[model samples]
Target: MNNRLKSVISAAAIAVGLCFAPVQAADLPHVVILATGGTIAGTGATSTTTVGYTAAKLGVDKMIESVPELQKVAEVRGEQVAQIASESMTNEVWLKLAKRINQLLAQKDVDGIVVTHGTDTIEETAYFLDLVVKSKKPVVVVGSMRPSTAISADGPINLYNAVILAGSKEAVGKGVLVALNDQINAAREVTKSNTSTADTFRTPELGFLGYMQDNKAHFYRMSTRKNTADTEFDVSKLSSLPRVDIVYGYANMDRVAMDADIGAGAQGIVQAGVGDGSVAAQMMPAFRDARQKGVIVVRSSRVGNGIVARNGEANDDKEDFVVSDTLNAQKARILLMLALTKTHDTQAIQRMFYTY
Candidate 1:
């Protein structure tokens, strides 16, 4: 055919193809998966070997590629944020991750975010992001108990459900969510209950926020506490978070740990005390010393669930200490770190513990 006829035919074909194309990718929700190495990205020696595996073996790209069904739910993309196990998660990584999420969610095209984290500290990271993200766009943190290379590797399905949850409009403004084993949990309340099980993450007392079933997210309740955009925390300019340490309380526990943390320049201390957040008599002196030296003290329970009532076992009023309403020791530490950045007043920090 002549050049003119060939060009005309090509243009016509292009136009026809455009008209027949399914909805463009731009029409779909743009969900970014930030991979912060965990069991979800882990690999085992054999399919049946669930334990004794290596973590952070796979990258975000590989995880995303393994889940083909994710494309139908959202415009998926992945970024490898960190390749460290969640137990080794540091404040530096937390700050960097939070800043990145805030930046991504601020873009008009980015609808939500899915974070693949280790189950060990996924809840802590999720709660940290929930308080500091400053965006209503859904952020779902998902992980797996089994390695991605296991026989029944739960990572792929969990990752898929996370993307679905992140892209859902109903999930927005409900705070950070933990999606795993077909369950949806609020970051503020979820905890890792089992060491090695698919259904490890749980909200024992209040129950999970919802579930991921039928390839979609279902919500039964939302976090009433302040979170996400509602929180006043801003980690944009922060290079590092305050030094906060958790001291586990036990029978005949001494103040050595508390004193050590204080001596090491801990800006805040979380007492993972016994029932009702009680402080051991020996630890009380160190707590008082910490308070005298301008270190914030927070009373949090080691128990799996329940509130650490203020002024119940410990004299919060006399000691000028803060109580973690429903926050566990680790989560309380996270909040106290952030709270220290804004204020040193015990009452203000205590209010943060209650509200956030």
Candidate 2:
């Protein structure tokens, strides 16, 4: 055939192939679901089965099966990274999960990612992912208040909303978020507020970032917190973190526990202090000693809603401790642990506390 005739035939063939090729659904977005076992994956025989049943039973496939509508919202794929209770989650587990999220977000075809986690420590994991996973695509962490076997099980709806939030364009570049009870919360500010209520997770200070309605997610506020993903610290550079412990303060508190944790080689300590983040008079010396010995000390209020004071208390100020502004005790612990991985300098760590 002549060269011009051959070109005409090739163009016709290409046009025919384009017409036959599959097109993505009109409203659907490409979403990757990373399932790490939590209450959402737990199974129980009774209504009060919060602590009575097997965990990690649902896995990713079964979770997607329970929420078939997710398929309509996004081209969903599942990968089970772990199947442990949220309480059993550790720094190593977080590192593995962050790495997986990084890999998924790197894919051009993946528009977003959703994580199924247990409510017990979901906030911690969510915050950890927010800090470390460097992705412009949305990263949503979700869990249910009740297990699948319980009456009025909330996992299906929560999962459905999670997929919708993950697939939404508004979610992009919003840092990591936790979608639960129809509320979209910033990872840095959200925390588990109740044990049994469906509305368990909340962002006390800044309120929710947004919410899900009519199969779509709506946003009213944006997160301003700086994160590891947006910082100089790289996730790949983190391997293992130094030991960190949460020390609670109460009347007649024993100093032995603080000493014990420090003696046990804890590299970081978070003090869940009384109102205004006050450490007990007796525990002050032990905290100072720990700080002097090179352990990073962070003061966080157990009050749940207010900032821990930094300069008013003489002893606390003298210890050169970092104060968590408005972050609850547990969240402060997670931040301290992550910050320690990057630097042990108290000043730099303090800046992290203020910023993230």
TM-score of each: 0.93, 0.90
Candidate 2 residue lDDT tens string, 44-148: 977767657776788899889877777777899899999898889988888898888888888888899999998999988988888788877899999987898
Against the true structure, what is every candidate's RMSD? 5.1, 5.2
RMSD (CA, Å), candidate 2 to true, equals 5.2
Local distance difference test scores for all models: 0.91, 0.85
Q: Over 4 Å off in model 2, which ranges? A: 1-23, 46-51, 315-317
For candidate 2, list the clashing residue pairs, or say none.
none
Residue 287 CA displacement from its true place in model 1, Å: 1.3
Q: What is the lDDT of residue 249 in candidate 2?
A: 78
lDDT of 1 by residue, 1-356 (tens): 89999999999999999999987777789999999999899998899888899999899999998999888889999999999889999999999999999999999999999999999999999999989998999999999999988987999999988998999998988999999999999999999998997888889879988888997788999889999999989989999988999999889889877888888989999989898898877778888988899999899888867888888998899999999998999999999999988999999998898899
Candidate 1: worst 10 consecutive residues by lDDT? 302-311
